[model samples]
Target: MRKYGIADTTFSRVDMGKIAYKIIRDEDDEAEIIRYTVPGIKDLPVAAKRLIDEGCDGVITLGWVGKTMLDKYSYLATSIGLIIVQILTSKHVIDVTIHEDEADSEEKLKEIAIDRTSKHARNLVKLVKEGKNALTKYAGKGLRQGFRDAGEID
Candidate 1:
């Protein structure tokens, strides 16, 4: 009965969209999933907004940033834009971003992408099905998608 949207960028080196879509499909069977593929990170905000306008309860935006000053600026802009879209639509827009420099090797990059996208997709399912309270238990628990949790502070 619920509708969810996935907005991904083709600029990513890894196929994060596919991973996310698969995870969502496997995790939630009752919800409807709609996906939009864009050319770059900067384009994700609009895509996500459109999906929300089309009646999605939430949207997951996936993007990859390069190891450059320009890329960093672009990422910041994209992030801000996503926030704006969320505000305008009064919907949840989960931003999942990976920086190319985060991993030293291609294998590591792929691993990070898979882990991050999969986890976020599951989170999306939780959010749409159970609402924000489902995630409140994780507050201050030091959670990380691509890597291990930082653990709770004593």
Candidate 2:
């Protein structure tokens, strides 16, 4: 009976899960948006599938991973997120990504962390209310083309 889905894990930069919940429960006017946040990406695909099964119109992901892995596994993690979004999109699910900077040490990182977090969070709330946005608005279409998911999204 819900219109949207939320999924996420814990990270240092920003609380993507928390933000998603606030957007869905507080900002969103839709009476049937179902919000959920878990410990990590482990629950993402299952959650996405569940949304699809439940007839959710869209999905939002909020999660964080260290930017230290940028040269390492970050690509893989991003790829996985993209694949899930794509799969869900192919099935007609509206996807959105709200990228959050998890790099807490770098000065620019910190600034971006705070700035993007606020911007994304506030924008998310506004978008949810208007029911007119998706993650592809930031991360591009090929990699993300369905509901909204914030990978390291604060």
Candidate 3:
């Protein structure tokens, strides 16, 4: 696998950053992971695009948008931006998103973020070396409750 980039928002600073590195080390130890924390979710595309141009094979981004009307707009904009980045760069920008409404409390947000980010990070190596079916090996490993990825827990 080639060097990978982690482009996360500072909103989920603690959990996002921690789990990104953890999974890279524990699951894909040979990877060279570089992280860039942007101020908000909207900047994910910029960071990801820059990373791709700088020679990263792939990018994984993590962020949470609060349950608000404004946040909904921000989330949509961010999603559209990332989609464009992926299309233009021809690289996968794995977006690990957690909405405030998805969890009842901060603890749950952290739980979901760690679970999601780790899964995406683990997939980065395979995504570069093995293509899109990176984590398909673990498919059907767990139940898909809400928007959380399955196989995160049993």
Candidate 4:
């Protein structure tokens, strides 16, 4: 059996818990979901900490960082906070976010958010339920911003 938690921010339109729920339930595995909603990106770490303290084997934090300069700085702070939370709690905090600039329109943003959230949820299962063996499936290999998914240059 595995237990998981979802930390979502109230400011965003994306619903990470709902996405995670669909994916987790499809696996037909026994698991408990603890949903924690936070005010914004900055609160993600604290909410994740709460889930860890609650005995959740893993946590998935879903949030969005707008393209504004202030939001970007806030995202950096949130990322650092999550790092600290992981070090202190000794638990997995899967942070999934879609930067506002990643998509040019609202619909595009929603599409990206849905894709990122669902995929990361699967990763959560791979880690907490299957252990370290999940690393066998690596990502970002031979991929670059401009090169996209192309293999080695040479």
Off by over 4 Å in 2: 11-13, 25-27, 67-75, 88-154
Give residue 133's error in model 2 in angstroms: 9.5
Candidate 4 lDDT, 53-114, residue by residue in tens: 99988888888888899999999999999999999988889888878888678887877777
Rank order (by lDDT, best first): 1, 4, 3, 2
Write down the lDDT of every candidate, Cα atoms only: 0.92, 0.50, 0.80, 0.82
Q: Is candidate 1 or candidate 4 better by TM-score?
A: 1
lDDT of 1 by residue, 104-143 (tens): 9989988999999999999988998899798998999999
Where model 1 places Cα greater than 4 Å from the true spot, the runs are: none
Clashing pairs in 1: none
Better of 2 and 4 by lDDT: 4
User: What are the TM-scores, per candidate, against the unseen true structure?
Assistant: 0.97, 0.52, 0.84, 0.88
* Winner by TM-score: 1
Better of 1 and 4 by lDDT: 1
Q: Which stretches in model 4 have alpha-carbon errors above 4 Å?
A: 139-154
lDDT of 3 at 27: 66
Question: How well does candidate 2 score on lDDT at residue 115?
Answer: 47
